[model samples]
Target: MATTNTTTPRPGGRSARVQAAVHQAASDLMALRGRAALTVPLIAARAGVTPSTIYRRWGELSDLLADVAVERMRPDSEPADTGSVAGDLIAWAEQYRDEMSSEVGVGMMLDVLSSRNGVSVEGRLPVPCQCAAFTASQIRTIVERGVERGEPVPVIDTVMDTVVSPIIFRSLFGSAPITSAHTQTLVAACMKTARLLAPVEL
Candidate 1:
């Protein structure tokens, strides 16, 4: 007896596929030309879809761009829990450096965040917000773990603002390149600081 593999596309599958294609095209365009150069017609052409299709789905070029930026800046994988805070933080920092150094990742983030000097066309910087949330979540997890182990919950905000933010800002501003060495240094510094701040259990 032969068994047939029967799987049908869900009702929203086509629209989802189209949305993903549109996002991909927008990301590529942003990487190549920046957000200011993106347009609905260009994205449609790149995605091999109609402008009407894009407009119908996203309503506006800015909306499409925002979604694409969010998708690109969002973490593709969760940070690993290596049972050592320093190791985990170094891994995360490396990932962050890799993402911020990419044309697509950095371009999309700056575009979405700096639109109109903090006034994005979408009325919110979804890309930056998502990225920050992910980072914060990871930091929170590490801090909680350290606290549970009778280690100090270091001031995460300061470390993020000082070390991590600089890498992202420099990369986005084209002021400097974020090399692996820089990331390693930042991670090491943060870890040392955390160790210094480690709380003693009573």
Candidate 2:
């Protein structure tokens, strides 16, 4: 008789169950002990998977964190077209600021930024910044709408800077998070600089 080749199944098989358990455990640990206390051994023990599983899948602490953190963070969803560029822009901006200032949103921001901001491991950059990218798409959509109307829209980069930079600065540095009023004011101010930015009720 030939001997059978039987290998014990890897813990959780890299399926959704394993990933969910690992992700949940990682977050719970982060909340309890802070990022400084994170480690493969610690996470493995917490996640109930072997150290090899995490190492093979995630490679290192930063990579594991970036993976988990990105999974949890969500950017504001794109708003439906309101048939006016300024109106659309103001609506999206309000949603964006609200998302960023919410308790859940603030925690997500803290989780990602606190995890070394993509410092590399084995020369590999940490998790990609997909969290705030959806908001940028809204900006593009608004700018292109103005362009289509034959309005002299500012360049996309300029429009983004004019609209987003100050809001982020205030969110990160100011005593209070930005409000819908704040975003509306910025949107109105940016509109003042271009024909594409024609005044509209925000």
Number of the top lDDT candidate: 1
Sliding window of 10 residues with minimal summed lDDT for model 1: 1-10
In order, candidate lDDTs are 0.66, 0.65
Model 2: per-residue Cα lDDT over 60-173, one tens digit each: 777678767666643324455787767877877776677666665565556556565454565533433454454455566676677777665555555567777776667777
For model 1, how does the per-residue alpha-carbon lDDT over 1-202 read when each residue is reduced to its tens digit? Answer: 0001112232368888898888788868876987678789998999999999988866777666756665555544556777777776777777777766777666666656654433557687545465576566566666666666666445678557756787778787756677888878877777666643443321
Which RMSD values do the candidates have, in order?
Answer: 8.7, 11.3
Which residue pairs overlap in candidate 1's backbone? 152-199
Q: Which stretches of candidate 2 lie over 4 Å from their true place?
A: 1-21, 24-49, 59-62, 74-77, 120-129, 195-202
Q: Judged by TM-score, which candidate is best? A: 1
- List residue ranges in candidate 1 displaced over 4 A: 1-18, 28-38, 45-50, 56-62, 114-128, 192-202
In terms of TM-score, how similar is model 1 to the real structure?
0.67
